[model samples]
Target: MIRHLVLFKLNDGVVRDDPRVVEGARIFASLGEKIPELRFWECGWNVSDRPIAYDFAINSAVEDAEALRAYVEHPEHQAGVALWREFATWVIADYEF
Candidate 1:
């Protein structure tokens, strides 16, 4: 099995109240369930004082590395990026056994 996790920090001035931001999150959360490779997915807001709080994050588990790769190339995920492009300024990550 493989785990795929991604975290994002939204661009300055972007807020949860914005319809675009809301839709982006919803679309990604749903995409996790729609893809065959995505076994688990969770997303959230950062209430902590961490510097990364400005970004939206996605943590997902996949069947394996191949599936993880496929997940990224998948059409739905590609389409999803369109929404992410609107507000993300930076990202963080961790991938391991």
Candidate 2:
């Protein structure tokens, strides 16, 4: 199996109560379901309790490294990533065993 982990840090000014950011999160969450390779998904706002922690984490499981690669090249996820980069500090990585 493969684990696709993404962390996002949103700029404070445009982070909370912002429709675009909110929808962006929601849309990404929805995309996970639409994509067959995605075995799981989780997302949420950053809590004040954790210092220097990311605002959100999209934790997903896929069949293999190849499936994760396909997800990265998929049109829908690609579009969302492009749009999301404009407003947040995005970081991602994946691993398998």
The candidate 1 region of ten consecutive residues with least summed lDDT is: 88-97
- Models 1 onward score TM values of 0.84, 0.85
Candidate 2 TM-score to native: 0.85
Off by over 4 Å in 2: none
Structure candidate 2, residue pairs in collision: none
* Error of model 2, residue 97, in angstroms: 3.7
Clashes of each: 3, 0
The CA lDDT at 49 in model 1 is: 75
Clashes of 1: 3
Compared with the true structure, all predictions reach lDDT values of 0.76, 0.78
Please give the lDDT score for candidate 1: 0.76
